[model samples]
Target chain A: DVKVTQSSRYLVKRTGEKVFLECVQDMDHENMFWYRQDPGLGLRLIYFSYDVKMKEKGDIPEGYSVSREKKERFSLILESASTNQTSMYLCASSPSKSTEAFFGQGTRLTVV
Target chain B: DQQVKQNSPSLSVQEGRISILNCDYTNSMFDYFLWYKKYPAEGPTFLISISSIKDKNEDGRFTVFLNKSAKHLSLHIVPSQPGDSAVYFCAAIGNTGFQKLVFGTGTRLLVSP
Candidate 1:
């Protein structure tokens, strides 16, 4: 089975603090993605990496950034946590664009 | 604007009834469409998918129907069970090969016994 793991399931931080949410996939997939899911808004893509060190901005990438240094790991970074940025973050990996993706359990972030 | 849209925000069905969830897309370039189911505090899981060329695809109790001309799709669940309650997201992808998927707002389905 394919597994995508998020380092933290829940996080709390003060506003203006820098936050790092880690994700790792064991499937050795070529594509990795970070998405933020909000109530009613559904899943909004933040960033996606097609290859090692290659990244593209998704629909919503304003307050966030991502890093894909290696094939099996992709990380999402919040430069400065804001109250409005509080939401559930999900990580996913897929073999290619046409294939189904495997997702991590997700990390709920709270900014105060 | 949302390229993919799920008009119904929520739907309720009794167990053993048929649950129909609808989705529409504005982009004509999309060649692949997929459905995902998500539970509270958990990430969205891939449920079923249908290619643009095919009209219907089935996997056990879950079936996906696609109409290329209307750019519409629907997911039908037969004999709905309590375990079927979750948020269903419809996503569309064009073969840009970059893997950028346009997703709908999602519809929450609740099955009651």
Candidate 2:
């Protein structure tokens, strides 16, 4: 079975603070993604990495950045955390061009 | 605009009955469709999938049917059990290789005994 683990399950940060969410996958998948899920808005992609050091902006990449220094780890960074940035962040990984994606438990971030 | 839509926000079904969840997509370029079930406080799990090349795919009691002409897909769960209750999300990926998926808002399913 594939396992995707996140660094934190819940986090709280003050406004204007920097935040980092980490994800690691044991499947050695080539594609990893970051998504923020909101009620009524669904899961919107924030960023994705196809390979080490290669990243692409998804539909909603603003206020967020990602790092993929290694194949097994992906990190999402918030330059300046704001109240509006509070959301349930999910990390997923899949084989290149494959439809099956395994997701982590998700991190619920709260910005106050 | 929302490319994928799950019109029904919630559905109720009795145990041992069939629960059908529907999803629609506006993008005709999407060739792959997938259904995911998510329990509260947990990440969504891959339930089943159907490629455009096939009209129907079945896995045990869960089956997915696709209608290319209408760009509609449905997930049917037979003999619904309490464990089947969860939020079902329909997702699609375009023909573009390694493209990101467009997900529906999701439908909450409740199974009663």
lDDT of 1 by residue, B1-113 (tens): 88899999999999999999999999888999999999998888999999998999999999999999998999999989999999999998887766676789999999999
Q: Note the DockQ of each predicted structure.
A: 0.71, 0.76
A3-109, model 1: which lDDT tens digit per residue? 99999999999999999999999988999999999888888899999999999999899999999999999999999999999999999999974468888999999
Mind giving the per-residue lDDT tens digits that candidate 2 earns over A31-67? Answer: 9999998887878889999999999999899999999
Name the weakest run of 10 consecutive residues (lDDT summed) in model 1 chain A. A94-103
Off by over 4 Å in 1: none
lDDT of each: 0.92, 0.94
Highest lDDT, which number?
2
lDDT of 2 by residue, B11-113 (tens): 9999999999999999999999999999877888999999999999999999999999999999999989999999999999999877577799999999999
- Cα lDDT for residue A31, model 2? 93
Alpha carbon lDDT of residue A48, candidate 1?
95
- Alpha-carbon shift of residue B92 in model 1 (angstroms): 1.1
